[model samples]
Every structure is written in C-alpha cells, then in structure tokens.
Target: MNGRPVRVVENLNHALHESMLADSRLYVLGEDIADPYGGAFKATRGLSQANPDRVITTPISENGIVGVAAGLAMAGDAAIVEIMFGDFAGLAFDQLLNFASKSVSMYGRPHPMRLVVRCPSGGSRGYGPTHSQTLLKHFIGIPGLSLFEMSPFHDNRAVLAHMLGLGEPCVFIEDKVLYTRRMAGDGQVDDLFDYGFLGAGDTAPAHVYTEAHGDVDCLIIAPGGMAERALAAMRDLLLRHEISCRLVVPSRLYPVETDALLDAARHAAHVCVVEESTAGGTWGAEVAHVLHERLWGRLRRPVRLVHSADSVIPTAVHLEREILVQADTIVEAVLADLRGEGSPV
Candidate 1:
C-alpha cells in the first residue's frame, strides 16, 4: 500500500490488476476501456495494456457486452463486464435476470458462474437523467445475484476478489462521485468521527462511524453513495442540533445481513435509512421491513427513510440537487423523527 491515502478509482484499478494477475481465467470487457482512454472514469486504467489478451474493448451494446460476459462465465472463465453508465444497465436486464442469474441452478447441477458487472452508478456529478441514476433497487432480490456498492470505508480490492471467489453473478455498483474521493483510514472519517467494523467471519462487514462511543440518539443506515452524505449529516446533527448519530455503511447491499444492523438498532432511540435511489420498493424499504420484523414493538418510532425525490433527475445543477438526497435532507429527516413530526410509515 502507498503512504498516501488511495483514491477510490485507484483502488479499483489495483484490484482489477491484482486479481487478473492472480487468476489467468479472469477477463475484463467493456467499452472504451482500452489503453490510451482507460474507460470513462479511468477505473480500468493500465488494465488493457497490462493484459492485452484478457482486457477487451467492445462495441456499444450493453446487452451484448453482458451476454458475452455471461457466456464466458458459463465456460468456466471468470468475466467482469463494465456498464458504461448505470442507466444503460436496464438495456441488459433481460440478460442478467434470465441468463446470468438462472444459470447457477437451471442446469442439471449447480454451476459456478463467476460474472461481475461493474456499474458506475449514482448521481451528484450533474450527468443528467440518461447518465445519472441509482437503479440499485431495480436489481434487488434477484436469485443467485449478489449486490454490492463501493464505499470509501471498504477496500474495492477485497470486494472484487471476494465476488470472484464466490463464483456467482454479482453487481458491483460504483458511485461515480466516490471515484475521486480519498479513502478513509486509521479508524477515522473526515477527522470528525471514529470508525470500526461490525460483524464477524468472512462476510462483508458493516462500518460504523460515531463521534463518540456509547448510545446514540439515532442510527443511520446508508450504503454506497449515501455514505458521505450520511456522514455529513451525522456531523451537522451533532455539532448544530446536539443530536448524536451513529452512521452504519454496509458494502454488501443485497441478501440483507441484519445481525450487525439489529445490534446497532437495538441501542438507538430511532433509526433511519438513507439512499440515493427514489422512494418505493427500495433497498432502504427492504431493510426497514426486516428491522421492523426483528425489532418489533421496541423502537420509539418507525424507521425513517431518507431518499431522493420520486421523479426523473433534471439536467440543471440546482434541480438535480433538489431531486437527489443531500446531507441537509438527511439532517431534516432525523430531526423530524426526533420531534415526532415524521410522516406515518
């Protein structure tokens, strides 16, 4: 590791390089990912030149790219497909839903389909509607498909390697804004909060950040792109309103692991979920449902959900900000819940 803090994009590039070197069967396929261009976000930088035979640049076809990756996985070779923009993932939904996901069990015996679809997702860069959208909820609950989101707290190297090791189809959501941000280290976040990991064993762990240890007024559960926003809200709430909050960021988004979350929720007076996606049938809703089921009749109020507006993202910078979930949005939601002014669940 370097002495300086590693950027999220650099970490991902390192993971791809290291994983490819370790496993000869690993291949990376995407558009404009070849050397000299190194992809739109530069996450695939130096990959093509280093492994010319393994790293392939294909034509513009989201469906075809994913289809080819799925076919490669079925042939016993691990493949990683990069969807240029998260919005275009919809074009390849049929391939992912029917072919990639079902191949694990549809055959006579359980097959190991080592396929990873890396999507540069989420808004905040003012990429407009077609280019910006956090569509994680749409891919949730797919059988044999594991969902993960990139965060500053978790190492992308481990995430990529772990998914490949699982030998199943995985959707690795990379928040575009996170690419340029420096990763947190030494049990610290923005020099304002101390952080630590919860949950034991090999599974991906939830990262908990707090200004100080002990009981908090509220526990905020956020994933991926919402981590920074959640942390900002936590800081503002504590500094301005004296509302102590504990922020929990999980790397794995799907197949909800509630042990760590339940432990944290039990101690807080209130709980809130923050996400970039719009309301309705969201990952936050799923988490809230699970928490309610497990922590029945013990919470002060219903789990508050803080999310983006339920509308298409606008191209204007100010309009996009209004549509997306900002730090202030989270602070207000938490404050409302504390004041008993939150909407009914």
Candidate 2:
C-alpha cells in the first residue's frame, strides 16, 4: 500500500506521526525517546523532532511515565506511553490497574481514558532476563484494559488510530523481533501462503494464512511475534510431512473474540496454540480452554499448548534458545498432537 515494504518499526513511527498531526491533544511520553536516540527500537523515531513539545523524555520511571499519561488522558488529551522493555511494565501495574483502568467506569459518568501503553516485548534476541520477556499475560483480565500485539498482517497505523479512538486504556504489545521484519501489504504474505481475515473489517480480526486448498489438518493460533515461527512450522508441516496447517495470528490478545477462532478451527482435526511466554497461566492456556469449551465433542483430540520452558531466560544465546519457543518446537508439538502423543489437558 506504500512506496516500499516497510518494517513494523517504520509503520509504528508513521502511525505516531500521522496521529500527532491529526490530533493536537495527543502526547508521547517515554524514557530516552526524544531526538537522536528516537527510542529503544526507534518506533518513536522522528516524533520528538516533529513535535518537540508533545514528545517528552522522562526519567527511568515506568510508574511515573504511566501515571503522568493517565493524568493527561483524564484531562481529555490522548497520551501514549512507551515502555522501553516490556518486563519493566510490571513496575507500572498499580498505575494501570488502580488508576487508568478503573477511571473509565468507576466514576458515575464514563471517563474516556485515551491512554495507550506501547510495550516492546518478547524474546529471540539475547537481551537477557530483564529485557526479554512477554509480560502481557499478567495484565490480562484487568477491567477496561484491552491488550493488543503488533502483527505483520495488520497495519500499525490502523491499530494506533483504533486504540486512540477507543477512549479507553490499552496495552499495545510490540514484539522486539517484529520491529525489523517486513510487514505484509495488500493482503500478500508470499507466493506459498495466502492470507485472509475472519472477523469484521473495522475491528481487529485474526489473520489466517494457509497453503491448503482443502480441509486443514491442524489449526495453529499464535500472536504477532510468534507469526514467523508459526509460518516456519506451517511450511515444514506442508512440505516435509504433507500435513495441511493453518496459522492464525491475532492482533488483539486479551478480551479475545472467539467467533472467528471457532469458525476457522471447527474444521481442523487438531488445534495448537503457540506463544513465547513460559508455560502455565498463559494466554495460550486460556485459548485452549476456550477451544475445548466451544468445540467440545467435535474435535478429535484436546488442544495443545506450545510455549517456552517455565524458567528464567538465560543470557547465553544457546541456553536462551533452549528455554524459548522456536519453529522446531511448534513443528514437533503439532506432529505429536496429530499422533495422539500429547496428553489430555
């Protein structure tokens, strides 16, 4: 839809610029986000230079940053807070949970808290434990707080615009690795796979990519960051094993809409969820539960969840690889589940 294929980071930067130009009341608050530095991943690049007064660089305080954004949002202004590392978002839990989320419905009248906390998350790079973690699961189920992930299929411009228009607080999770990956444009992923949307055009819908012309044998559900891995596995399953697999990548994580998911998964014999988060109390687990309930008695086997090992992420590249979910992990999980080797949930 543009001159050249842009990366996720560029799309985000463009979105921020367009949003700033459209709305004078919007402000960007973050640490080391101003000027020459741009941001940790350059998602806010050129923003400070373009809008000096609106783009503010703050101290190393996640809580303070979010709190100030919330205050600004309450005053009828839109505020976007950028958390350099997704792990550090835990420091702002109180501000998000008690203040921003509740302010929407706690008061007699609904206060439009046009606040969006953009988190650069997920692991693949050797950023170590403190820097590389997907902590969005902790913020799930919080009232009035919507969760979103940046995907190649969905335009970041549309995502940012939608979040600002929601008039509510939202946590936008950006996979650190996805920043450099080329985004899919014109509904074209590649020559092998075809892409389509399952839900309404306006809202965030699950992106379905598949090579299968007939019924798919397996349906794999994953977030944006995990899309690459899911695709890799999808390719391996189709080419090496002759198995038809459909990959569904969703932009919205929490408060997940299941109508599209159920429609896509009902035909598949097996459903598998892949995530970078460690096993247990994960978004994948929640999805598995939902699939079990909705597709009960219609499925061939229980849903399988593929995730990282339940341990602290290591710094060494090889060690970290072992702990995190990889493309091979997904392929193995799908094969195992198909063979009836995966135990019941």
- TM-score for each predicted model, relative to the true structure: 0.97, 0.96
For candidate 1, the TM-score is 0.97
Q: Which stretches of candidate 2 lie over 4 Å from their true place?
A: 1-3, 211-214, 343-345
What lDDT is obtained when candidate 1 is compared to the true structure? Answer: 0.89
Candidate 1 residue-wise lDDT, 1-345, digit = tens: 568789989988998999999999999999999999999999899998899999999999999999999999999999999999989999999999999999999998899999999999988898899899988999999999999998888888888888898888999999999999988778777666877788653335556565445788999999968888888888899889999889888888898878888988988999999999988899999999999999978998999998899889998899999999999999999999999995645
| lDDT scores of the candidates, listed in order | 0.89, 0.88
Steric clash pairs (candidate 1): none
Off by over 4 Å in 1: 201-203, 211-213
Please report how far candidate 2 places residue 289 from its true position, in Å.
2.0
Q: How does candidate 2 fare on TM-score?
A: 0.96
Ten residues in a row with the worst lDDT in model 2? 205-214
C-alpha lDDT (0 to 100) for residue 188 of candidate 2:
69
